[model samples]
Target: MRQGRRTGTTALLVGPAAAFFLLLLVLPLAVVVIYSFGERGAAGGYSPAFTFDNYLSLATRGQAFLNTLLLAPLGTLLCALVAFPLAYFLAVKTSPRWRTMLLVLIIVPFWASQLLRIYAWLLILGNRGIPSLLDLLGMDGVRLINTRFAVLLGMVYGYLPLMVFPIYVSLEKLDKRLLEASADLGAGAWGTFRQVTLPMSIAGVATGSLLVFILLMGEFIIPALLGGGKVFFIGNALVDLFLQSRNWPFGAAIAVSMVAIMLATIALYMRFMLGRSGLRQQALV
Candidate 1:
């Protein structure tokens, strides 16, 4: 039948992508789960024995877990705060030609390697950089490099583009007539924005925040490079466990725990956002 031929063709088109997904993503996750329940070999790899000791050992890295939980949300909040205004202006205020140019400028940094960007930040924020300028200004002993502040700055700069684009897309797709309607109903600028503009852009804000938060949760490079091995996060702990200590089982346990925590956090956050929106809708009506 023609239907049979069409189905065969569809499968043929999708077969390689499906195979790659299973082979690369699903299989590696399955291996990690299997290794998490196994014993660590004497020679520094997984051994064929069932045990929960690895999961229990996670408590030893509690400080790393605490540090990550603190820093990740802080970075996500700052990213959202800085990006929203920039995105709104670009989407709502700027001329089309200038908007295109500015958006491109925002994304241009992403084309280069993230590592190279962070390394550039190191020199700019180092003793020979910002501190040198401060010294000339009579503010001696000012430090920027290898501190928590440097880590925060690096994370915000690195993740700003990811945060901005989603919000810009949302604001761009917004209905402008609603603002006119709000104004016709005697609403002031702030009132119109609060009742119409902000509500409509909630989807974009939620999407951008979730995207930034999820990535920040797994981020290791910013803390490692900017924090200069002085700051400890679960990501750094995982790297040490797998590469330095050769503790595969414990590393798998940490990864699995991180996945579980992120899923739970995201679910709760979505519920809160949806509930708040529902309440706002009722109030508006």
Candidate 2:
């Protein structure tokens, strides 16, 4: 009787949370999945009939898919390049007195809306901004805004902090005595870092890379604002289908495809990461 009461109490505690999770996350995903396999009504939105027409419509957005596929990884790579060095400097090099201030500076931008920050980038990179400044110095016709470069730049800037904090935490937790021991064994700075530091911080690198990659794949706003609609992503295509074209079935199909692709990509990425870690361990041994 007592054990039965305990089981009931545990269920009572977990029931609401499970219900909320299903309602918020599972329900929406289920709805999208169901909508994807259905037909769009003549008046827009989902119709009762099941069909493959919506999935077939993806070919129409080929260019958008290609662009998103190519650039999202590029953006993620760029973010890692910028973030890792900055994170290392902050975590490994900076004095405690200055580190706090620098970290705060890095994080201060989050208090503002992302929309507002993207708009700010618009002014800073536009024709009258960086271009005009360059022209004054005899470097004329420097177009920065609305280009692929601008889109990549905005993505890097927007997500750099997210990329940094994880790596920073990893680096911060590193055992400095390990470095000292390596140096005593005549290992050069580069050797010590390559064998010890890099291996140790691989987790952070993978975390940041995955975070940036997955988010970039679904990015629409950066492309819309910085690409100026010229360099459209699949996300932008989905937006148009659902909102502008009112093709709910097609939009749901696109959404489901994106989710499936992301899941597959992340799984492969993890497998590669795990294999790499095992190889590094073998090499060290």
Candidate 3:
């Protein structure tokens, strides 16, 4: 009777979440997968027919794939590079008062609309903005907006807080005794950080990187607003296919392909990070 009750309680707790996941996520994905195997209708939506032509035609959007593959990782890397030091400073260097205030400042941006923030960046990087400032310094013909650089800048700016908070949490929870031990062994500042601080905080770095990279994969708004259509990502391609061209089958195929790629990449990343962490633990032991 107790076991039965426990099982019932477990099901009660998990049933809602499982149903929500299936109803929203899995069902939609299943529909998309089905649509991907069908044909484009006479009008705009799907038609009941099975074919591989949609998948085969993915080559036409190779540039979109290339751009997304390159930019997403690059943007994630840039976010990690910029966020690490800031996170470290907040977790280790700052006093409690300043840390709280600075953390609030970091998080305040997120409360605002992402579109509005990107639009602000659009203006800042426009011809009359930074380029004009550079022209004042004799760097004429300096274009900031509508470029890959602007897209990357926007991505880094938009995603930095996501990267920082994860790393900060990791570093904050790190054992201070390890640092003291490293110092007691006559390790210098750099040595202590390298041996103790960095390795200990690797979890945060991995978490932050994963968060930033995954989001960057499906990013459209940043590139759209900042790149001004000069740079196209897979997300943009999907938008065009489904909305503009009304090629539902092809769009579904692209979406499915993107999901596959992201899944594979994430699997590889998790495996690598886990292996590295295991090796580090062995070395520490």
TM-score of each: 0.90, 0.91, 0.91
* TM-score of candidate 1 to 2 decimals: 0.90
Candidate 2 local lDDT, 4-99, one digit each (tens): 999999999999999999999899999999999988789888887688987887898878888888888899888888998899999989999999
Estimate the overall C-alpha local distance difference test score of candidate 2: 0.87
TM-score of predicted model 2?
A: 0.91
Question: What's the lDDT for residue 144 in model 1?
Answer: 94
- Tens digits of per-residue lDDT for model 1 on 57-82? 88898877887899899999999999
**How much is 141 displaced in model 3, in angstroms?**
0.6
> Residue 277 of model 1: what lDDT?
71
On lDDT, the stronger of 1 and 2 is 1
What candidate 3 gets wrong by more than 4 Å, as runs, is 1-13, 279-285
Per-prediction backbone clash count: 0, 0, 0
Estimate the TM-score for candidate 3.
0.91
